[model samples]
Target chain A: MSELTGYLRTDGRKGIRNVVAVAYLVECAHHVAREIAWPHRDRAHVIGFPGCFPNAYAQQMMERLCTHPNVGAVLLVSLGCESFNRYALEKVIRDSGRPVKSLVIQRDGGTRATIRDGQAWIESTVAALAEAPRVPMDVSELVVGTVCGGSDGTSGLSGNPAAGRAFDRLVEAGAACIFEETGELIGCEEIMAARARTPELGDELRAAVAKAARYYATLGYGSFAAGNADGGLTTIEEKSLGAYAKSGASQIAGLIKPGDLPPRGGLYLMDVVPDGEVRFGFPNISDNAEIVEMMASGAHLSLFVTGRGSVVGSALAPVIKIAANPHMYERLAEDMDVNAGRIITGAASLDEVGEEIYRLVLDVAAGAETRSEALGHAEFILTYKSFEPIGPACLPA
Target chain B: MTTTDTRLLLLSDADNVLVARATIEAGETIVVSGTPITLPARVIMGHKLARRTIPAGTPVHKYGAPIGTATEDIAVGEHVHLHNLKSNYTATHSLDAARAGAEGQEP
Candidate 1:
């Protein structure tokens, strides 16, 4: 493998993309922050929490996102009265050796003045980040995440397994690969548990999925969507089985929650379901929420597999969309990066497509713009949630 | 037109349903497990089709696991979709209704 160059952070982490994040503390400030990012869409991205009330999970997630390796600087836009701790978030970013500035609308005059000030700050940050030193990074330094959205029957047969194949190769090459959505993995818990590195970890895996099952049962809904059924997926378990294919064949290293970085490079399962009673509505309200959590765990880039077709990108990291159904790929060719549907059509084998996805990862890491990035799909979202810290066994020894 | 040998994918030997890699028209002949059967209805690409006779209330296997229970008897080559099958976990809301709700019909 060739050496890849990335922006070197003072904390010894490397960023594949040095992005200037414009974050709004509440929904009130979202418009101004978004206006600031609209012109410099390629260099700056908008990310924030919409709630006026305080949420520890949201705060922790924002802190992690601001300090994410991909982020070189942060511009916080606060409406001046929201409960989010802007001071603490700024301190965390500054502690990571990245430039951070917070603009409060109430204190800074109004919307027009705040937008102008935020835009000016964003420009300078981008310019300064352009001068940041670039250092050679290894595959082991890369944290990659995989997720499936708009899934169909073909997702498991093609896109997901192809992503799994790529994940297996990346894991073998000593890269950290993460797969998430415990609620979606309910039916395949037994099979997935068997792939855990140790028996205790396997038990943890089963228990996590069991908790997800119970939580969803209480809500009277599965993560399974109406579109999932329209695309020939019958049940949540079937979707879980399909979603499970993205883990590849490697022994799962450990399980981690959102914002918990993997100890070392290998396959890790992200337990996204909270620890207590069903509190946060549905864990992940949407696909972007899942992507945000993965980014919180330090994923440099994400591989998003879709059969019904999804066109979503992240604020901190880039997303590579892999199309599973040949028909959907035909319809949404401009949005997809990899056409895993060829595996089903016999035009390409799984290994061939898998290698294509793997090479694309390296290429994207090397500064190639994903289709979503080029088209400017920097979608971000954070919501209310609660979680008890993960147990020690969750991380590999 | 492609034959079933190229257009249908059997995920595993244990799977009782085959995924349609491409759209298969009604009356099209499909071979599964060395037996040739004519499709009873058009199966859309990415959808499932019964590879063997599945009686009503029997678990329908795809990817080698039960995806759902058949609501009615499904013959070989019959399309297995929402009409004849349902999720074992929860009642699936219709896409049209969900879309309507999403577009401010409920709020």
Candidate 2:
């Protein structure tokens, strides 16, 4: 295996992409932050929460994202009166040995001046990050995540299983692979639980899906969309069966919540559903929210499998799109990176596509831009959700 | 045994449906379980086709697991979709209702 070079962080994590993240503390300061990041589009990304209400989960998510290994520096754009803990967020990023700065719009003479100052800070930060030393990084040191969206029937048979094969290869190589969206894994709970490394972990995996089913039930939906039905998926269970294929056939190492890094390198399930009553409308309101959760868990990049096609990339980590439906792939060829749909067409076998995905992952980690990245699709979203920490059994020492 | 033809695929031995690898128009004849049956309706690519006669209320098996329960008797080669199958997890939220709900309208 060949080695790849990455930016080394004080937290002992190696980042494939070193980004200067300009985060708006509230929606009020979004435009100013966006203006500041507009010029440094290649190396700087804009991310933030829209709500002004103080949400512990949102705050924690921001903190985790700011300190993410991929982030080399951070600029906080605060609206002065928002309840977000800018000082604490800045402190976390600073402690991570990354350059950190905060610009309060109200204190900095409003939009124009704040934008100027934020732009100046971003420029300086990017310059400083450019000089950051690169070190040899191992595949085992990487954290990869998988999610399926806009899925159709062909997704399970093609894109999802092909991604699963890639996941299996990564896991066998000692990489930490994560597959989530318990809401989509409703019917495959029994089969998924059977792959757990421990009986307790199996129970945890089963309970997570059960929670998702009950949660979606109260919401009067099963995470099934009309497009899914239009794509020939008859039920949520069928969709779940396809969605579960992304995990491959590796033994699930543990169950984790957002912001909880894997204890060791192996396959893990991210329990995204919030604990307690369904206060939040849905566990994941959109595809990006699931991507955000995966990013918080320290994923370096995410493999997004889509059948109907989705053109989304993350603010921090790059997103690799694997097209499932051959027809959709042809229609959205510009947005997709891998043609997993070829499996169904018999032009390529699952293992061939799997190897292609694996090679693309390494290439992307080595600085090859994914189709989403090339298209400048840096979509990010965060919302309110609550969760109790994982039990010791969830991640054995 | 699996078919060498790319137009249709049987995912597993336990699956009662064969997924259409390509669109099969109405009146098209396809072989399933070594028996030829004419498609009763158009089956879009990625859609399922009944492999055998199934009774209503019987759990629909795909990938060797029950995906949903059939709501009406399904004959071989008929399209297996929402019209005759219902999810066992949540009550059927029709395409219109789902679209309306996604757009913030009560359905």
List-wise, what DockQ does each model earn?
A: 0.34, 0.42
RMSD of 2: 3.2
* Residue A243 displacement in candidate 2 (angstroms): 0.6
Give lDDT for model 2: 0.89
Candidate 1 runs further than 4 Å off: B1-5, B32-36, B96-107
lDDT string for model 2 (A1-397, tens) is: 7568899998899899999999999999999999999999889999999889898889889999998989999999999999998988988888898888899999999999998998888888888888888899989988999999988888999999999999999999899999999988988999998998888989999999999989999999888777888788889999989999999999999999998988789999999999888896888988999999999999999999999898898899999999999999998999999999899888999999999999889999888999999999999999889999888778855
In terms of docking quality, model 2 is: acceptable
**Chain A TM value for model 2:** 0.99
Interface RMSD of 1: 5.4
**Top-TM-score candidate index:** 2
Query: Candidates' lDDT values, in order?
Result: 0.87, 0.89
Quote the chain B TM-score of every prediction: 0.73, 0.76
